[model samples]
Target: MLLPWLVTCLAGCAVILSPVSEGCGPGRGYGKRRSPRKLAPLAYKQFSPNVAEKTLGASGRYEGKITRNSERFKELTPNYNTDIIFKDEENTGADRMMTQRCKDKLNSLAISVMNLWQGVRLRVTEGWDEDGHHSEESLHYEGRAVDITTSDRDRNKYAMLARLAVEAGFDWVYYESKAHVHCSVKSENSVATNSGGCFPGGAWVTLEDGGQKLIRDVCPGERILASSEIDGSGELIYSEVLTFLDRDPATWKQFFTIRTESGASVSLTAAHLLFVSKGNCSGGEEAAFGSMRTIYASDAQPGQCLLTTVTGELVGQNEEGRKGVGRLSRISQVNMREDVGVYAPLTRHGTLVVNGVVTSCYAVVDEHNLAHWAFAPLRLLHHWTGSAGGHVGDTGVHWYSKVLYWIGSLLLGSEHFHPWGLADPWR
Candidate 1:
């Protein structure tokens, strides 16, 4: 099953193809922006990503097994490419359930975490990548998780929306710098294969759908679930669901910790926004551009989650600012972002992707922390940016342009100067 040839190409086989400049991507700016396309949020008392997967019945990218009982869970679509409106499913995946309680949580989070200016509408992509993570990380088998992104490919949304998620009701959360959110209700341990992983007592639960079996375990009493991260180099290891025990229903209803990745697991939602960068090994300049692609997993699998990466064509870039002569491994994710941010733009552009605060490193965003001033949701408009450039005189996409773009939108996207429904074109 290992495509060695493809892997070799990805690992620097050749640079024959010319690098093409794709057009600019969607940006937030001042003006009559489009109506925020809000879809029905996933509700069902946030489960682990694995639970969300199993509930959705996923097998892989476009194939799955579904059931009527789990169809409602699958109805909530994550960020996928097609233009979908409402929570209804046509081109995307949906099979989870959200009672009135779940829906209300989402609506509240949307308003509470919204930046008023930067994040007008949000997209939820890969809410449930169904079996996307490695074995032992499948909450879908237990039915508890979801992923959400902005429909407009907004990176600023990742930081703030992640914060808002805690205000809703979720435990195990992982934000991708790659423009996607992977969440679950049950606190999970993703480092079963790592050295710190202690699961000798952990029992495996078998989840099989369409030729896929998810290997998982349940922790009884108190056990550690850890997630951590290594800085700068993108070595992320952040744990959620620490000190959780599964045998008793009473304790199950209570809060417990699940140890995440150690050393490198900084936060569960580190990769909240997806960013793309390409540099040739042959001593050349790196070509980094932010491109987004969306996929829905709930459709194929009605109550299962299965994630597998696909092979993509290459478009290599050499140091000479020219594209050609190398095999470019294609990579894509929804709502991804760059780890580093420069202050030339909003100075405080959104990247903290959470509506809540970090108690420990891997703890979920708690509602209690949402109101803190230091823990405030990110802002797109700072005095420096406002005085520097308006929308017309703003920087496009270079060296983390999302910050600058968000700043310019203080003029275009925010409603600070006007009241709702007054002169607000976006309202």
Candidate 2:
């Protein structure tokens, strides 16, 4: 069962993410953490009369959980190592979204490579496992990286696996320990590079909405060059607007993933603004807004003018791109009540500068960067999240969308897009 496997694996090996909380319903991924541990937070009534913000990962270090998908593929080999899966050891590569054919070939290839050693069972270490906290570079995120392990004199086996994988249409293969191997493929370039290089195609992405999407890139001074968009068929949907601009996507702390005219799918993060904001200013990435019992006036002096704010209790679209009204009720300070406040107001017409919940940091706020400044101060109420034993998978709740794009999530492939976009003819 994926559920038990998810739980045990998460608690044991650092493989997959922890079990997500079941309240939000399937695909609604709030509680669905990649690991099994829970975040220590205060209940709504604990600290009202205060307001603040907290980071998603500020809770603690990565707990040992087997949440990655790599290990799942490993069990398919005719020669399965049940013990490896049972133990809380690192995995080789089982969780990625690899096709079955690729999987069969991989197990055989790994075994064949391991054949170089004598009397030693092959154990895997980190195939498709997520890149740990420090290094976000891995084929694992895309289901392409695999880590194979061994404990004997099999240098030849190590070389054989890496070498064979490249020959078998898989490229990036290398050895890193007395007991393991790492292998992956480049995003493009038909010719594989066993020579050991990074994935092909730099990070920026093109959409089909007469707009360009800057896929998640973290370079400090990188700019968001102008581009077009993708279309309903997931193809470049725009007329040639390839003229590049001096704007940087990083600077906006905001970028659009417009593929159609409906504007439904969008992704944003705080870092998307701070260091990446259009120009360059050492704005504090850490300055933030949080929910508490009551909203407190910004540390700014009294004369400072601020757009008034209303209680953010539901999801809706305002001037600031897409905003998420927190579900927590009593944003009280001290983790008591959902103490809510504007780290920076989630303004929509200007640059995004609010220190908000991690989602605000990542997905809230609009493209203009202007936060929807609150007319009223932040406040917490009991059951702020509004999901108490009543609504389960109900579509009755509605929200205005700021996404401004259409998405054929089921029928689209990512390759049809380009640097600018494809939103030209039919949406």
Candidate 3:
């Protein structure tokens, strides 16, 4: 009877000690918690396109991504900085063919150098598998070296360029007697050589097809005279005698023409004419004319004609001499009377004046000169006239007005004086 009474009391205690669900609070014995704090939106600084690119640092790397012996070396397309340019040297000519590895390394060198010199562009005069005259063991043959031209023709500038190239991480920097700066990267254990300040002899190897190439300095005041034969099909059969007169390449432009002394004339593409220091034949290899064909047209204006540059979309002025011309599309304008070369207002320096001034001026830039892309038009405008305020960047003007300003700046040549100046504030 005592045992039964004790068990009944224990059961009653268990019920009374059990925990209460509601009295434990909202979060299992914890107080109410607050929601997560909100974060403020980030503020970013605005920058112009050029500054933005520069701030991002080098667009390429110095390391050769493609190994020297790898098959990919031939197929690789290396990413290169836009500021670097490739040029043909006066004596050595230009060689752009390079392994993918060397191209990246070159772009890296260009970026590092540009960091030190503002508005400076690197011109790679030579690269990759040049003639055997350089040396069988030369890094250039292996696509590990390049020849860079100095910013200015001054020897002091060349020295500065060499010093900066060394600072830019080039393993070998050679100031080649004011001609060009030679830079290379070699293996740590491999010995690298530079010419120092001494002038080297027999540095250039004769190009394999140098004999067959027609070398002409395409420039202003240059004339071409050609005589052609025709077949029964009325198509130009071949050119019998083609004569090319030499002119300074510095004066070269986009389109050029050749007229025979016998009143017969043919038009020639100025872009096809290669500017060389010296050579034998001076004409483009015509497709069906057995290396020389002359197209005859009565519309061919007889007289000394000017040539213009055509590469990519930009047609007028290319002082940098970067890419080769695509084709001679059409003769835009011509002046048969005036022997004097005139400037199409706001056009590039060498643009020959024909019939009359070109009504429009277009601003342009190539891959090498992209650093100036933003200011290309401004520079072209500044080359001649004073800045007119209402013309280019006026915030108060209508958006359509601004568009007209750019179009007018690009097309119609400048007039005597336009009321385009900005108003003085609080005047």
Greater TM-score among 2 and 3 belongs to: 3
**What lDDT would each prediction earn against the true structure?**
0.26, 0.26, 0.31
Q: Report the alpha-carbon TM-score of model 3 versus the true structure.
A: 0.25
Ranking by lDDT: 3, 2, 1
Candidate with the larger TM-score of 1 and 2 = 1
Kindly list the per-residue Cα lDDT of model 1 for residues 2-105, writing each as its tens digit.
Answer: 25422332222111111110111133432334465353333333322332232211111112322334654453333332322233343334423332333444
* Candidate 1 similarity to native, TM-score: 0.25
lDDT of 3 by residue, 1-427 (tens): 5344333333332322222222322445334242322322111221111111111111111333334466635643433445876664533332564545456556676775576567776777776544554754566655566777644444445655665554454444565545777666543222111100000111111111211112221222222111111110111111111111111222212222333232222222211211111112322221222222211111234332212222122322234322222112123333221111111112122111111101111111111111112224333333334331123211122222233334333322223102111011111
Candidate 3 error regions (>4 Å): 1-80, 88-94, 99-101, 187-427
Indicate the worst ten consecutive residues by lDDT in candidate 3.
191-200
Clashes of each: 136, 136, 10
